[model samples]
Target: MLSVMSTRDEEIYRSCAGELTRYATGLVGPFDAPDVVTDAFLKASGSSRWDQVDNHRAYLYRTVLTVAMDHHRSSRARRAREQRAAVPAVAHQPEIDYEILDVVERLSVKQRAAVMLTYWSDLPADEVGRLMGVSEGTVKRHLDRARKRLKEWLS
Candidate 1:
C-alpha cells in the first residue's frame, strides 16, 4: 500500500530539490545528479529518525553525499570486475582526460566532498563539516590534504 506523504515532506522537497540536485551534481557529476538526489531523498525519508530530525535539509545533504560515495565505490568495483573478465576489444574508446581523473582519484571521498562543498558550494568550513558529519578541524585537514595533492599533481 502506498502511504501518503505528509504536507511538510512535500514542502521540504519542493524547497530543497534544486539546491540538492546542484550539490549532488558537484559530488557525482551532472549525469548522475538526478538519480543521486532521488536516492538520497528516499533513504532520508525512510529512515527511522526522519520524523524526529529538526534539520531536514542538513540530513538530506549528508544522505546524498553518502549515497554518492556508495555509487563511486560500486562503480569502481564494477569497472574492475569488467576489466578483469573481459577480453580486449577493438571498439573505439572515447577519449578520457586521465590527468584530471588521476587528480580526482588521489583524494579520498571525504576529501573530495569537502573540497566540493567548500569551493563549489561556497560554504564555510564549519557548515561543510556539519553537512559532512565531521568536525570543522577534520574538514580543514581534508581540504589541506586535497590542496597539497592537487598542487603537487598539477604542477
Candidate 2:
C-alpha cells in the first residue's frame, strides 16, 4: 500500500515523520509514538482524499493527533481492565525519567498537545491553535495551565 503513495506523499512523510513522532510521543508517550505515527501515515496515504489535501503537513499533524488520542483512550481502558483483574503486588520498576512523564500525563490531552507543540515543536501559537482546531487565545490558555501544573509538580 505504501508503494502506491505519490512522490509528493512520500516527500511529506519523509519531511514530517520525525516531528510527528515527537508530537505523538508527547501525546501518547515514547513507547506508542512510532506506532501512532505509522498508523497516521497509513491512514493518510490510504484516504480517498489524499491527493486533494491542500495542506499535507497540517493534514498529517491532525491525523497523528487523532491517532494518538485513540491510542490513549484504548490504553486507558486496558489499564482499567488490568487494574480490576490483577492482584495488588509490588513489581520491580525500571529506572527511567518518571518525573517528567508524570507531570505530562496529568495534563488533559488538549493541554498536553498544546504544550508539546508550543514548546517542543517550537511552533507559533497561531500554528499550534490551527493544528488543534482552536483559537490562538485558547491555545495560550492551555499552555498557561500546563505550565502552571508542571511548575507545581516539579516544585
Cα-based lDDT at residue 131, candidate 2: 90
Root-mean-square deviation of Cα positions for candidate 1 versus the true structure, in angstroms: 5.5
lDDT of each: 0.83, 0.83
lDDT of 1 by residue, 54-141 (tens): 9999999999989989987777676568557977656544455556556677787788889888987899999999999999999999
- Candidate 2 accuracy as lDDT: 0.83
Tens digits of lDDT, candidate 2, 3-93: 6667877888999998897798788876667788999999987898988999888888888888888888878777568657977446533
**Residue pairs in clash, model 1:** none
- Candidate with top TM-score is 2
Clashing pairs in 2: none
